[model samples]
Target: MMLDRVLRIVAAALIVGGTLTAHKSSAQDGAKIAAGEVVYNTYCATCHGDGLVSSGQTFDLRRLEAGARSRFENSVLGGKGQMPPWKGVLTSEEIDQLWHYIRDNAYQK
Candidate 1:
């Protein structure tokens, strides 16, 4: 009976640890998202629209799905359609932050 109780406690601890690790891995850090938001407002909002809302004049950033990260990076860095390349204008870190901000506002999320 003592062994059974110990096993149950150990199992519970493992489950809780697994749950915490999963949550930490799945959720984007809030600080990174906030920093991304600042970068977006300063550099992207002019065309992407404020708060990621588009006026239908440009691509709606919120429409991008979770799997669109690579496309996002490519487009921003190389430019797409009428958008200008931001490769020289923004650092990779700033671009990553912008991605986080856009991800946070994504419709699928």
Candidate 2:
């Protein structure tokens, strides 16, 4: 009985660990990043730089952490520092995709 219980616990732990790993792996995608690049080129290229390397004020978004997504989204939508607000210009989903793209590729590494 103890053996069965141990096996069950191990199996459960493995399942949970696998699920978390999959979620982390699929959290970002290239297509979404491409779309975000388009959105950025169309809207934010002038100041932020199409290369995502402009070294002015405002935190470089490429290295933003997952925990900062909400605050960053609000900041992007509401405008902060020298960056303009984009609440009306872009949908929330699009903003998220852009953020994910930036997080995944834009000077982050």
Candidate 3:
């Protein structure tokens, strides 16, 4: 029936749309993470170490889990322990990119 055919076409279109959206999101995340890496190397490598690898003297960035975004942002913005605050130095978008970079290289992920 024409109704059945139309329903099948609608379902397929929905599935394809969802897939494309997910793919686009993933690609955007990858781009953000790459940009974040550049920012990290410029600003954080001195203390955080290269490629998120710490030398035991500093906190290992890779140890941060996925659910730690809020904590991460808070610490970076307000400063944590000995770490200096980056609130004035970095924009929110830059911070978000840094988070994506960190999350991408997380040990657990």
| Candidate achieving the largest TM-score | 3
Q: Write the per-residue lDDT of candidate 3 for residues 48-80, one digit (tens) a residue.
A: 998889989998999999999899999999998
RMSD of 3: 1.2
Off by over 4 Å in 2: 1-28, 106-109
Please provide TM-scores, in order, for all candidate models, with all chains considered together. 0.81, 0.65, 0.92
Candidate 1 overall lDDT versus native? 0.88
Clash number for each model:
0, 0, 0
**Winner by TM-score between candidate 3 and candidate 2:** 3
Which window of ten consecutive residues has the lowest lDDT sum in model 3? 50-59
Q: Write down the lDDT of every candidate, Cα atoms only.
A: 0.88, 0.78, 0.94
What is the overall TM-score of model 1 with all chains considered together?
Answer: 0.81
**Listing every candidate in turn, what is its Cα RMSD in Å to the true structure after a full C-alpha superposition?**
2.1, 4.5, 1.2
Model 2 scores a C-alpha lDDT of 0.78
**Lowest summed-lDDT stretch of 10 residues in model 2?**
100-109
lDDT of 1 by residue, 1-109 (tens): 9999999999999999999988886565666799899999988889888898898999999998989889999999999999999899989988888888888888889
Residue-wise C-alpha lDDT for candidate 2, range 1-109, written one tens digit per residue: 9999999999999999999988876755666777888887888777777567668654666667767788888888999877889989999778867886777764433
